[model samples]
Target chain A: MKLTTIAFDADDTLWHNERFFTLTQDRFADLLSAYTERDHLDERLLSAEKRNIGHYGYGIKGFVLSMVETAIEVTEEKVPAHVIREILDMGRDMLRHPIELLPHARDAVVAMAKSHHRVVLVTKGDLLDQERKLSESSLRDHFDAVEIVSEKTPDIYRRIFAEHGDGSERSMMVGNSMKSDVLPAIEAGAWGVHVPFDLAWALEHAEAPEGHDRFRVLDNLGQLAELVGEIG
Target chain B: MKLTTIAFDADDTLWHNERFFTLTQDRFADLLSAYTERDHLDERLLSAEKRNIGHYGYGIKGFVLSMVETAIEVTEEKVPAHVIREILDMGRDMLRHPIELLPHARDAVVAMAKSHHRVVLVTKGDLLDQERKLSESSLRDHFDAVEIVSEKTPDIYRRIFAEHGDGSERSMMVGNSMKSDVLPAIEAGAWGVHVPFDLAWALEHAEAPEGHDRFRVLDNLGQLAELVGEIG
Candidate 1:
């Protein structure tokens, strides 16, 4: 009954955000098919991630911009104007598409809201893209607080807990990532429930921490309610 | 001909290495089909890579051991003894396989030898594995010196140049990796010819150093002799 606050990650947690970008990138690959191959386009994207890390940080917007820049550079000024417009159109689609909630995300958030727990949506991305997602999800009203951050680290979660809770162990984080969400919350001295996504990028698949006590990886979010109920 | 020294990498460079490990991993995936899925097994390997960094250093031997240990843990004591042997046998195959040179590895080494260049094989691995590779390569005769090192750093190339050459721009490096082979050599004021491999692991990809002119990334090593011939 001491559980006071619950934090959730945005991308791949409540909705299918990355799949949109992935589809957009596959289209970008098709756009460059005349000039280069899919693997080559992937290479440029990988390089762009490394290049734009400082400028744009990380997210769909940065990725979209990088793809545009790469298309021009790869074609050596021979890229047609129609193709350029198509690339921009892809970005527009990524933004305009409605947020698609995961299997149990909306239901879980609603259930938690009916309880007394303070729910927070903690996500890191471009301000506009993340805010647009919140507005579209319609579950934004369920959260008591929303944190749009540049990076997810232990300090950020600790700050949230320190300000929001009475330094209690009842605070918990539920997310699809071990690297960004689960580990940081655990390091901040809160419980972490990991909902493992079926597919992840190579960079996101690091090892779990030393012990099993602080972390729990689940196949489905439907199992989360039972875990929370048991914790109390 | 100004070229005097040539160096190389050990894993995925001299023989068919990583592909064997990948195959064995696929076999491990088959064995764990009942307990865990392929992606989960791969996730465990990624975790082991991060975990073993402090303990195992890096190489095929350590990776094999980690794979075996993960298989056992994931199977939860239900793993059969035969599966363990198959994994060990696969590792042994990689350890014992003949140094089947890449398309032009031997030709380039032989061509370099024709001009009286002091060929030095600079590889990083467990000491025994490196020595075993050199002995089996029949390449021991080609190399004037062989360094079985723990890593390839800027200091490594600096020491090699200082000890071997007359501190001239006459030394050059040829390898499949841009991270360990090309970048460090360029940093140490030596020319590097990079032959991009099909499966360049994330661990071995380096960004080009700023304002460095002594690096060239070729599609393959066959062009190495010609590239060096032009540079010299």
Candidate 2:
């Protein structure tokens, strides 16, 4: 089927996102080093994130909140107020951090935009944070539409494709996370292109659909446009 | 111009939203009563909300973050971990609270859905929270579209109207806040209908546009469908 629409996942797929989360998490471990081991602290924070995802969803704000909760839990409700303040500050810093486009991200988006395809950015995170990142990314103009969703599920992929393009059969989704970006889109009857990033969030991990006919993996985004050409 | 679209604001307009925030603020005041006077704490929290809107935007998560920041500031960085944990719990509770429809909210939406006009929910807040509220409100199927934005501006209103309906000239925005729901939509060349809620956030206060031809103030949503009929 001809790809009438190409949707790219933001965050790690288009730019340097998880790295900031990682950096802030390292700072979190350091701040609470006096109260717990680094590994245990990390584990608690991940659990908090997973547990709170239903409440807080995804973004720096939720991440910061989870960090605060973890610190309190690990310290047995005695985590210092200064530590909480520092954690909030780290979240603000993350919110205000400059957008760094991943390698070949711009070229891939430009290629898709210039093609006969409808180029869309489908991302799930804090709406304001995602909008701010896109505005600062200098890649906003290349996209025909931007959807900042609450989550990336099969139903959501189906609706987005139907709304923004011909249908799921004539659309494609490319991203870093198999669980969020690739598998769901593939499940929705669309081409799912996986461009593996160097880092992945623990919650976003899933077994790759290696045997699926529509599933394809790329080493980087540099080969994305060429692959699309081959598919077309 | 013939009206083809009616966009309703979500929070204080279609649902009992600001009251929960008010209730939470009362709890916040009580939690920090030992550290400062209630009036001073309220003022500080308002200031923090205003100052951090650019950083956090509008939502319960931002409100909670501001509360955390205010608690630390007012208590001189010794607010105690329990207070922080309490604040985080408050945020989670807000997120999980069941949806409460405002007066005539359901009937007005139903009437608009039956009318020959496109009905849309235009709101500014946390994406997930808004979606969750809508999903629980049992009013989801009534609207033609839902636009969860960071902020409502003339440009945004213009774009949304153009995308969802004929144009701003043939559209109307009904809501509680004169600042967010009325002014910008009117500025975008659409009719702005104000349905005043009893409580208002400090950030949302603005003078009513008395003489504007396209501006109309309703006591509640019960008069909305009739007003649309009159406008048409």
Q: Which candidate has the highest TM-score of all? A: 2
lDDT of 2 by residue, A111-143 (tens): 998886899999998898899999999999999
The TM-score between candidate 2 and the true structure equals 0.99
Off by over 4 Å in 1: B1-232
Instruction: Name the runs in model 2 displaced over 4 angstroms.
Output: none
How good is the docking of model 1, as DockQ? 0.01
lDDT, residue A104, model 2: 93
The TM-scores of all predictions, comma-separated, are 0.48, 0.99
Question: Model 2 residue A145 lDDT?
Answer: 92
TM-score of chain A of each: 0.92, 0.98
Worst 10 residues of 1 chain A by lDDT: A53-62
* B145-205: candidate 1 lDDT, tens digit per residue: 6765556778878888766664426788777788888888877878876776686655677
- Model 2 DockQ (Cα-based): 0.86
